[model samples]
Target chain A: MIAIERNLVTPRWQRVALPIVSLVMASIIAGIVLAVSGHDPIGTYQQIYAASFTADGALTATFIYATPLLFTGLGVAIAFRMHVWNIGGEGQLYMGAVGASGVGLLCGGWPLPILIVMMALGGALAGLAWALIPGLLRAYLRTNEILVSLMLNYVAGLFMYYLIYDSTSFWRDLTSSSALVFPQGKNLLPSSDWPGILLGSFTLPFGFVLGAVLAVLLLALFRFTRFGFEMRVMGDSPAAANYAGMRTRRTIVAVMALSGALAGLAGASQIGDFGHVLDPRGLEQAGYGYTGIVVAALAMYNPLAVVIVSILIGALTNAGFALQGPTFPIGLVGTMEGIILFSVLGGEFLGRYRIRFGRAPARAPGLDDEPGAEVAP
Target chain B: MNADLIVSIAVSAIAYGTPLVLAGLGELLAERSGVLNLGVEGMMLMGAVTAFFVSQTLGGPGLAVLVAAIIAAALAGAALALIHAFLSITVRVNQIVSGLALTIFAGTIGLSSYAGQVWGVGGQHGVHQLVKLDVLGLSDVPVVGPILLNQDAFVYFSWVLVALVTFYLFRTRFGLYLRAVGESPRSADAMGINVTRYRYVHTIIGGAFAGLGGAYFTLAIAPIWTDGLTAGDGWIAIALVIFAFWRPDLLVVGAYLFGALSSLGFTLQTHGVQLPSEFFSSLPYIMTVVVLAAASTTLARRRIGTPAALGVPYVREES
Candidate 1:
């Protein structure tokens, strides 16, 4: 019988090759599923490719989609580096939109640059506030942040819905003929609109540039800063960090806050650049917050790599929208995403272990006798 | 409140809570075996779609179709759980990541939706569904009658399952072995217990339970195939396991309580209680967070029934 054995040291080539191999495997599996469902996988993939890469204005559309993912991915990456599971990116992003909308409405008449800066600060602060509860709980009470953050997502969603759905709420769009028809907030003033760079016939939002700049800043912080080193050390081993004089609690809270701020900025960008209004439907449609988790994971929690992964995911999402039809459903993208993630996770096992087609390694015979026997301490 | 209204509310609560109870019990079993399967949501979705599809296509004697649906759902759930078991238990990947991946893969817009579309089952009602039945001559009795005796077969089945699980976990030798494996796999292994075998069995059994719960959604609750039919109920079930302190008895009570919270909006509105629906809608989630925070104290986690080796892959070598 074949026996799987853990490797003493994984090679560098294996580390790089496994992810790509997993992606290819995932695609093959997905293709088989599509083919079984009576759809042409090759044709579907070509359509996705054509819509995302070759179609007119598709590149610009992808950039728009990538903008929020970039910010959220960075947010997730930073928190993950500190071993904090901040699954509340969706909630934080929504709250950020709320904060940005509050600022945008009040300061709509202000100068363009000042209004933009105010909106960003408002969004960041709102996200920070939202994440603070779980962060503090995790730090002080040793609460599981994963569940807390996830639960908060539902709360944030409802809170946003309540605000926009209320007829008397200031954020509600009074311009609509019937408030009951669509529950959406007012559009931002012309001055608060995000300026875009003209490319051919398409305009790319300034948020993309902002995301690129923040990614570089994050990389620098992780590589050269004392705080980054402490966070990394704390993540690797909390006890060792504590013994070495690191303030673990403070680091946890600070890292979560920073992560929330980035997510909040993503939300603000969604409003200022694309939606231009606080619409619940728009927020749900732009699943950057949830997709950001996948992007972050695909990047292996590296802020720099998040940029490239976000764009790739952004393109896939655009393709999903483009390919929406009776036979070719939008859910194909979600399925592909799930398949890719599972494959990558499984691939990690292959990277760390090797399979030997032979009998088990000889050792002291016992119920657990097998290859890769551990040396007794 | 009038006795009749209270009884009716309680009845609805039981109906709503049945799925949660089933899913929670399954999750508790998995957690007890030191396997944290976050894929409950995805597995439930798969089960739901499978049951719906089977019931739709078969269109036969109501009882037979229901049985078939339940069996198909359990199989679907178990199949997904096997993937989780392999990744977390054998391959030794991060349990959380594996679970999350499974859920995303089989979630509302993933494999479930794909299946629904492929089978032409989307936006259709179940051909057969579980109906509420009054046990013996208890229909005319007071509050207890409707709340306890008048429920779908699944509700009664859940009660039995809970009782069985409670007994198995506390009173049986195998159950003791399973708990030992979860608490300290190394010691269990040293004692000649197959830790891996126990974990695999319990986890798959848990997945089967989750599948039954998912089938309840299409077979009883809504009786229709909708994308995201469970609507975060799986997540709530996961929380319910922790909230109940890993006890099957408490899990039933907690499930019913959250069930009441979930259906509170409809009940209140029907009784002419004027309040924003959002308040009631968010109640279950709010309570989940509160319960998590309350149980999060390090002392509580230790003193409470959380499995000691929960979320940790039990590699014999590492042990």
Candidate 2:
């Protein structure tokens, strides 16, 4: 039998080697899938690479998908670090979109800088409120947050449908006959549109800049704060945290709120940076919230790694979008994301244990007969 | 407001709820063996898409084709679950993440959709739809007959499965070993139960059940193929297992209860009830959260039924 025993200290070489190996393995598996399904794996991959990077405006388009993913990835990474399992990022993002769009609509006459700040805050606060439901339940009532948070996502998605298709709410475009018939969200004024920094060829979004800053802030928060210390203790062992008189309950709520706020910021970015309107179908189709979890997992729940991972995943998503047709299927991105996660998740074992191949060790000395020893006829 | 409306809803409830019963029972078996597979949705989709494809391509007698399709679906789901089993059990990875990976790999946007596109199964009507059984002419009887007796063979099989599983779980020694493995794997191992074997077998069996559930979508309920056609029913099925407290007998109750909530939107609308369609659509999801919260609260008080070793990878040797 094979045995795995936990190592007191993980080897540094193993830590660095595992992720690279995992990615290579995932690519090979995806290649096999392409080959089996009547496609040239190498050619298809080269095409994806070209669409995502080499083609003109591809990098700029990648940034569009990357911006929200960066925000949501950080959001998910923070929550996962605490083992909170806040899978409600999808719902929280929708609520954030609602909050940000509401703010943007009402504050259209305000200056761009002020309007953007209010919209971001509004989105963050709304997401926090939405996340607090499962957060409070998990902390106080001991409800399973995974299912609760996931259920809320369905509810939130339906709510978005209600806002756009069913009701003539403020967000609905009632003024335009074409929009009224189609039932789309009202557009924000051009003043509310976020500006981007023009690079030599690629344009960098304001939201992506904000996410980078947030990543640094989050790193600092974890590394240099008493709250972070308490949170770490609580996450590792809640019972120990309780015994130590740390506010584990408050930390639970705070972490969830922070996570939800990050997802909300993604929603705010969706509105301010790209969509400029509450496009329900478009937002739902993007599924950036779910993809964010993939980013967070691939990054090993580290906020800084999340920045780089988000761009890489964002490029894949853009390639999927750009190449969607008879030749390229839309499902490839999700399948690759899943495969990547599976590889990384399995590779997590390298850091945790050392496997020994041998016969089972001789049993430790015992009574030799267990209690309730078998009595047979 | 009449017997006809009530009867119609009741019939549809059982019809719609059959998939959940199939899937939830599978999840219950897995959870009872200490494997919390969150990939039921993905497994179900694989089953659904594979079953549809087989039913379309395979040439045989109608019944034989469907049976073959069902088997193919089960194998597809089990194939995915094997990955999950190997990862969570052997690799000692986090089960939650492992299951989510399976979902992402085989889910609506993943392999299932890819397979659907590759097979070109979309926009084609199911030629081999599940026919409702007359059930010894008892289907012609009063309201109970239509509600209970008029269900197809798939629904009846689910009932038999529920009964068989209930007996196997409670009465059989093997079931006892399975429960022991989940409750306390260390103790079970000490008791000479093969914890690894039981967990692997049961988790894969659970995936098979999820496959049957997904097959129901194409063969029986909707009679069509579409990406994410199961919607969020698999998630609801996962929640139903909690509502059942991991008992097979109670799983049927929870499934049909949610089934009624699922059919409510369409049933009531058909009966001319005026309400926002989305509100009706969200009922099952909302109710799942409510019931799960309630179940969790009750569980916290009772402190029973949950397998102690759930989501924890068992290692015989110490660090």
Candidate 3:
């Protein structure tokens, strides 16, 4: 009964304070680092905040940049909640890009509606296929998903490189002057683009709605569904779940595939709406996929929390441009992002476990005997 | 297609594999000690850039290469690993998180690029190239003699070094202690072994080897410095350790195989092969993925064997 009650304690304060404390701490440390580096830290901070928020066109740019991160973050969150560590989001993203680009290039003269559906399906299928390899390996072979997924990122990267640079038949554009053989893909018609519902100046695209709806639906599924209950049980302790007769392997594959599809949607949506051409550099920034992991960790794998975390991340990215100057290269943005992520995560522990001071503790002989209890003080 | 191509391929493999062997062995040692140092790439790049400048300033490729590689890569890797060691062993930080952070710190485009510019002109232009180390009297033999006997000093040094490492790991008392720390630091600690000291020393030694591998690249293979020049070789070195099944002896074969695949791109290009350059370029990643996937299977992993506490941070008291 005591164990059950302890397990039932929902982490509420941690769910709220982690991000806020982390952000504040990051800003403070960033200020100190900037000052020591001889830059005017005050001006830099102001510029970043203004450019990301108050500046004209900043919000739109932020949304455009963040759309992929939103989808990938949720993708990561979905798999993470099911106890599947899917680090192959990068690979899945690339596969999705390949799929969507293939469809886009092939159906140039097709109707808008048909092209949209085809591109979406192609992207999702490609992502699903890419993810399935490791999923099966982890589920059946009991291989480490972390290593498999991480390695697959490289494979997917290579595949992208091969399509662009080697196989000319599928992705090559001989007509282009550049040395790189551009994968020929059908360009998206404006009609096929994800329409943005504007409010005053903000143009929130259909992707936003899809992301929000998915987040809510996932939260609901985790909260109410029997499958979700089983998944949660599996995540908490796979051995226990297995002993209880849950089909852990099949569930792992299902969750991972779902994760891959979500990431694929990110790639498709980005290309369909914002990307002008299909090329390697069009990968936005390898930020979306990895950031999804950070997001998952930050939100503690809660689907509902991912929404708020995504927005905060999106805003910071949007705001990062203002900090750029001739003297300080834009790479500072990446460094700052890393600092922010690490600091927040480091700070998150405070919210979860309370640390008390004034110790005069001596270990008892049976200290090792107790699994959760500390040595008596 | 002919005999010369085959000879060249074999020679290129040796040249390419030397650095990988050096790096892979270092990672093997670290992982064996139960600390996965993923910052191998950053350390190598740092070593490559620093070695270029040091060699250029000091003249004489032999001593300059040694000094530059040791000071830059070994020292740099050690310093980075110190951070990792502190976080993992002391603060109980997650190994993956610490590793990723270290990589980001060292791998930032700004840091590496700036270091390259400040160092000097690299990429086939800046420093004196290493002279080939010919084995005495054996150079005059037939095809096999020329191919095998005549090579750079680092190639022979790498082979000798790997052999020594294998011996030290399997045949020495200290080696047993190191292995024990890796398997279970708590058990090692309770048995009167200094786990922290062993982990630190071995981890630093591992860093030094990785650094030497990075230096080999600047001094030999590319013979120049470029930002992010080590590319993903450091990461590959980590993967190779896994592929080699944590045995120092197998590292020689695995590294050379990877090295051959890496150099195959340029070799094929030299012969004007019709294959796409991208396919050739991405061979390392593809091979790494295939190898890791194959090795990761439960049946295969049992056959290959992994360090018991691989990737887990050791907390003596917590146990």
lDDT of 1: 0.85
Candidate 3 segments exceeding 4 Å error: A1-11, A28-38, A80-83, A105-118, A170-186, A284-287, A315-326, A348-353, A357-377, B49-62, B108-125, B137-148, B223-227, B297-304, B317-319
Clashing pairs in 3: A104-A186, A105-A185, A105-A186, A171-A183, A171-A184
Per-residue lDDT, model 1, residue A64, is: 85
Top candidate by TM-score: 2
Q: What tens digits encode model 1's per-residue C-alpha lDDT throughout A1-377?
A: 99766676768787667767877898899999899889999998888778877888888888888899999999998997677988889899999999999899999889888989999999999999999988999999887787888788888888888888844577887676765586668888877898998977777788888888999999888889999899888876777899999899999999999999999999899888888788876686666777887788777677887888888889888888877776578667778888888888888777777888978777565644543323100
Binned by DockQ into CAPRI classes (incorrect, acceptable, medium, high), candidate 2 is medium
Name the regions of candidate 1 deviating beyond 4 angstroms.
Answer: A1-15, A178-180, A354-377, B298-302
TM-score (all chains, Cα) for each model: 0.94, 0.96, 0.86
lDDT of 2 by residue, A298-361 (tens): 8888789899989999999999999997678988888998999999987877666688798856
TM-score for the first chain in candidate 3 comes to 0.85
CA displacement after TM-score superposition, residue B98 of candidate 2 (Å)? 0.6
Full-model lDDT, candidate 3? 0.71
List where candidate 2 sits over 4 angstroms from the true fold: A1-5, A12-14, A355-377
